[model samples]
Target: MGVQDLLKNLLDWVANLGFWGPAAFIIIYNLATILFVPGSLLTLGAGVVFGVFWGSIYVSIGSVIGATFAFLIGRYFARDWVAKKLENHEQFKAIDQAVGQEGWKIVGLTRLSPIFPFNLLNYAFGLTNVSLKDYFLASWIGMLPGTILYVYVGSLIGSLAQLGMGERSRTSVEWLFYGMGLIVTVIVTIYITKIAQNALNQKIK
Candidate 1:
């Protein structure tokens, strides 16, 4: 199914599950990451289902666990397969070398900047010299900003949907803050990415 349909179905199913919904969402997110599913929709869906704070927390937990799992799979279970798959990825080779020297910094910068594909990078990192502890720590911390921004946007969308249906009320102040927050997040993410990209280039070179 498409992302929206999958998200809609998941929302409908989990909406009635009370406290268990978050757990289920995390598991689903973990599976999606391993399955190579694009996580943008799932992350946004978390905000639509939960709110900003809870959604960010849930997504962070799920994504970190998923990344760790993928890393283990690449390192222990499918090292040869992953190695063969990434052999031609010259960029990954540079990253592997860079990681040997920089360890978690490389992982953190790549995560912050979106310099590499998230799901693939999870597996690819296993081939590097970075420790699993460092990888997990860096991934969680680096991914937080993007997660919060996306979740906030999704929460806003959810609010707008309710507003359209006349099921909820929103104040002008709320809208103002939402707009400002989004703009600030976008700008901050851009600035961070630029710095990360520059630093990563120097390291990889």
Candidate 2:
């Protein structure tokens, strides 16, 4: 099946779990993260299913757990394998060393930006000298704003569908509010990313 079709099926299955849906979502999300799957679609699906507050919470929990597990696997279970995979990538080699020197600051900053793939970063950080505690805290905090922004967008889209796009559509005030919020989120994300990129460059020098 196509990737979208598979994701849709996964979401449908998660939604039908009723009382177990949230728990199932966490497990699925964790597994997906470990499997090197990009989670943007799954994260958005959570927002559609659970609304903003709960969706954000669940995604955060699942992502952290998955990242920790992936890190552990990279560090202990398959270090040689991960090393071989990244050995030719000079960029990642530099990041690996930078993270070792800078600890959670590097981790936190990188998390705010998409300088590297999320799943790969999870494994790459494991290959570094950063402590588990530092990684967990930095990742959680760094990933929060982006998580909330995506979930908020999903919630808005859900609301739009439920309210219908006809005359009963959202008020202009609501539209303005969402628009401003999205703009602010984008600006803040970009600002943090710029800072992170600069820090990364300095560290690499």
Candidate 3:
């Protein structure tokens, strides 16, 4: 079978598994994030299938769980190996030190900015000396806004289609909702990031 046919079959199989199917997929997807899957695809798919609010919640939870797993694995299993891999790099060493001193703030900033690949950040963080609690908390809070924004965009698309409006009108509404979601996401992200940054700076000082 062709690739599209295989994907169709896989989706059908997932559908046949009922609600448990998505839940199971989510667990596996989050785990796969550890292996460097670009998490945005999964998040977007979740939004498409589940609508915004619930999709965002599920994505958030799964991401946090996956990130925590990565962090723990790095801390206990692979820190030495990973460190050795980066030992010759001055910038990597600087980042490692920064993470040690201000890990939560840096995590929050990266989460807000979309400057780095999410999976890479997760694994790189895993190799850092940042505390598990700080890592989890920063990731959980930092990721929430973007998750909600993407999911809401998907939900808006679905909702517009369900409304049976004309194609042009639906497109317009989708853009409108997307713009609104973007504004909200940015505002909330900034506020939360500031809070986390302030707290981290105080703690570091």
Best by lDDT: 1
Would you list the rank order by lDDT, best first? Answer: 1, 2, 3
Q: In terms of TM-score, which candidate is stronger, 2 or 3?
A: 2
- Cα lDDT tens digits, model 1, 1-205, are 7655765677667766898999998998899888788788777677888989999999999999999999999999989989998999876766776676668877886776544689999999988779999999999998887788777766876632232233345557546655765665465455545554666787689
Model 2, residue 87: C-alpha shift (Å): 0.6
> Counting only residues 3 or more apart in sequence or on different chains, how many pairs clash (N, Cα, C under 3 Å) in candidate 2?
0
The sequence of per-residue lDDT tens digits that candidate 2 reaches over residues 1-205 is 9665676678778878899999999998899999988887778788888888999999999999999999999999999999998989776765665665567887886777644578998988888889999999999998887677666666766632232233535556557655765665465455545554766787699
Q: Model 1 off-target regions past 4 Å?
A: 159-205
Residue pairs clashing in model 1 are: none
Q: Compared with the true structure, what per-residue lDDT tens digits does model 3 show for residues 1-205?
A: 8433433344345446776867765685577667665665456556656667768888888788887887776667887866675568554444555666566876775666554457656767888767788888998998887787666655555532222234534456556656755665466455545554665677799
Q: Which ten residues in a row have the lowest lDDT in candidate 2?
A: 159-168
Error of 3 at 30 (Å): 1.5
Clash count, one per candidate: 0, 0, 0
**What local lDDT does model 2 show for residue 12?**
74
Model 2 scores a C-alpha lDDT of: 0.77
lDDT of each: 0.78, 0.77, 0.64
lDDT preference between candidates 2 and 3, better one: 2
